[model samples]
Target: MLVALLLLVLALSNEVRVNGERGGRQCGANPSLKPRPHSVSILEFGAVGDGKTLNTLAFQNAIFYLKSFADKGGAQLYVPPGTWLTQSFNLTSHLTLFLEKGAVIIGSQDSHHWDVVDPLPSYGRGLEVPGGRYQSLINGYKLQDVVITGNNGTIDGMGLTWWESFRSHSLNYSRPHLVEFVASNDVVVSNLTFLNAPAYNIHPVYCSNVHIHNISIFAPPESPYTVGIVPDSSDNVCIEDCTIATGYDAIALKSGWDEYGIAYGRPTENVHIRRVHLQASYGSTLAFGSDMSGGISNVVVEDAHLYNSKGGIEFRTTRGRGGYMKEIIISDVEMKNIDTAISATGYCGSHPDDKFDPNALPLLDHFILQDMIGTNITIAGSFAGLQESPFTNICLSNITLSVNYASSTTWNCSNVFGFSDSVFPKPCSDLDNPSNYSSSYLSMLSMKGKTMVSGSVSMKK
Candidate 1:
């Protein structure tokens, strides 16, 4: 069963209620749902909700017609109870795509059905391949005031064929995401269930004011590279009350990749993630880059439950990745049956291209992880900062992880500096000294650019 259905089985109302508005948790900007002045049903556009019918033309025609209402208080396109098969479609600004109860939007299984689009500016090339990538099932570009909500309607990506092709190396382009929003603002994706995404489910890139609340995301335990929610190169984001289980990172924050991301110079910041139950069979519950060339900072993640996962939280990047990840706080987290509770490594990713400067080094600083409790953890943490550019000001407080390490060190450290207090299992002696922070800061300030740097739990089981 999808975790979203099991976790959200109790709340069956057809209303938008953010945790903040309900008067319990105040973690994100409150974005309300105002009813659209004009509403149209998909049925009127000749869209048959039968699972076998392909309604690609119907969606495109409907959106084209709805674009005229952009100035007329926007509009709503209601999808009633049925499985609507689509190839790919674009969304208009100031529009609401509401899926009613038992409504489903399934992606076409044929790879050729998806549109081929150019790669993102920050990525320079396709994520998995060198050529252009396929467009997401639902795409929005340079729009505003878009909302994708429903009474827990499901968006199913029949991704088995895509995954099979990827594994066989027969794919020509990178797989398409389930839904993607690019360079948009005031976006809201709530009260929905996303399943079996080909790659990522709900990817908001180069966007702002994105609110993703009260949603469920699930992929099979064996699915490959199926991430839940990825907020890339965007800011002012809120993700709460979500239950996600996948093969990869439940929630991954990324900016750009290698020199391409460095050239883009856009960082992902001002994000709030809370009250999320995340699980990953082959990746971290929450991750930050392996492609963070555009920087990721000022992120707050709290009140999360990470259980039965391979890794809890990880920060991943490598040399030739010129970016910074700092000013982050992760608190009030509980972890169970995790392989690695926390980890940050400098040598953990591949470069996008050979043109990337081998000297571009990343900066990791000012990270605080506290108020965390874990049980049945194999490794507490493993911090491997770069020798040339060491990670600094890492503060760990009020953290307790029950780990049974027979001979290996509970916490592995290499060229990393931090301070630890009120932590069980006895962290490395390097973290005991807060005095090293000054030297590391001075070292970073004195150095210039272009320096040479050296670098889940299965749910079914």
Candidate 2:
């Protein structure tokens, strides 16, 4: 009996190790690429954490050393407990930037000191304006096996200046994010607290095999355009167990903008988002597009909670933005105090310019929402497709939502085709009757937990 117990313990340990390595493997990182035995604190590079001194050069010199050490098995740059004031700094590959508890990295308020990068090829211009974009507080490019984790350390972007400039239409370029990884692969960002980003909090663009978990992100509800996490034109990404309270969408997926995006066709695919708590002051909990002309597919959002958000699950695209969005699955969601429980519109936001082709209509199909519950919602569901190209093959089952007493409780659907079963507020006539659904249709709906995209992808749960 004792021998059997020992064997069982060994088996359990092996299982835990395997599970932990799954993320590392997906990110192209392995134990063999571990950081060198040497660890250096920022103080060693003459960094002063008095919260007033400029530490940009110190950070730069330290990262330069680590970059040179990349061939020497990499290195770890440690940020000790204090407020470190610095401008944007580039990160090196095969390195770890670990922040101790109580450590804070504060972005410098001087805008002129920030670095500027060219606009994205897919956007043809900055997303907000028509010029270059300011680099993020912690920016990386074309890196591999990079990890940013800490004991819930804070990275604060002093964005009030940028916000004022935007509201007053005095900005020449787009604001910077709190953290951004561009053209990077095998990245992991976890256990950090992000606050007051000028634009998006976390953005990973043109990257693949990224993992983000156990992070808390926040910004003032009144702050404009402060999105939480945006994965753009990337693949094989996973985001789990995070809390996001921001001004815009808690999590927005994107590929590219209008005509420029169609020319540079790189789609965002195979993303998994689970166990997320989303709160938005002015936007949706989970959103896609408003700028997705490069296409987005095979996304699974499950086990999410939303509070005081404008929309719960939303998809937005306009006539001039041509993209295909399909195979999206949302399951086991609970929402409270939301304006709209579900929304899909093809004419929500405006185009970048009149030069865009009006014939570039979006295509949407194979959307499924299941096992959802909502309370104090303004509208149970509002789905509006384009008159020229209607949405198709939407499915909803096992949904129960309560409309606010002061609001009309109804499901408004137009220019879409789909079916519903055991759904509240009764779906529109475009959907087939629940009783008339075939057994195969029922079986497909029942397979919600097994596969999010018809055997293409499986989530870790």
lDDT values, one for every candidate: 0.83, 0.81
Badly placed stretches (over 4 Å) of model 2 are 1-36, 433-461
Backbone clash total for model 1 is 6
Clash count list over all predictions: 6, 0
Model 2 is weakest, by summed lDDT over 10 consecutive residues, at 452-461
lDDT (tens digit, per residue) of candidate 1 on 1-461 = 22232122112111112222333222433466888888999899899988999999998888888888989878998999999999999999989999998999999999889989999999999999997999999999999899999999999999999999889999999999999999998888989999999999999999987889999999998889999999999987789899999988999999999999999999997777889999999999999998899999867677899998889999998899999998676777999999999999999988777899989999998776777999999999989999998888777777899996643678999888877767888789877675544444323321210010000000000
Candidate 1 TM-score to native: 0.89
What is the RMSD, in Å, between candidate 1 and the native fold over all Cα?
9.9
The worst-scoring run of ten residues by lDDT in candidate 1 lies at 452-461
Tens digits of per-residue lDDT for model 2, 9-117: 2333243234323443222232233545667899999999989999999999998888877776678899999999999999998778888889999998888879899
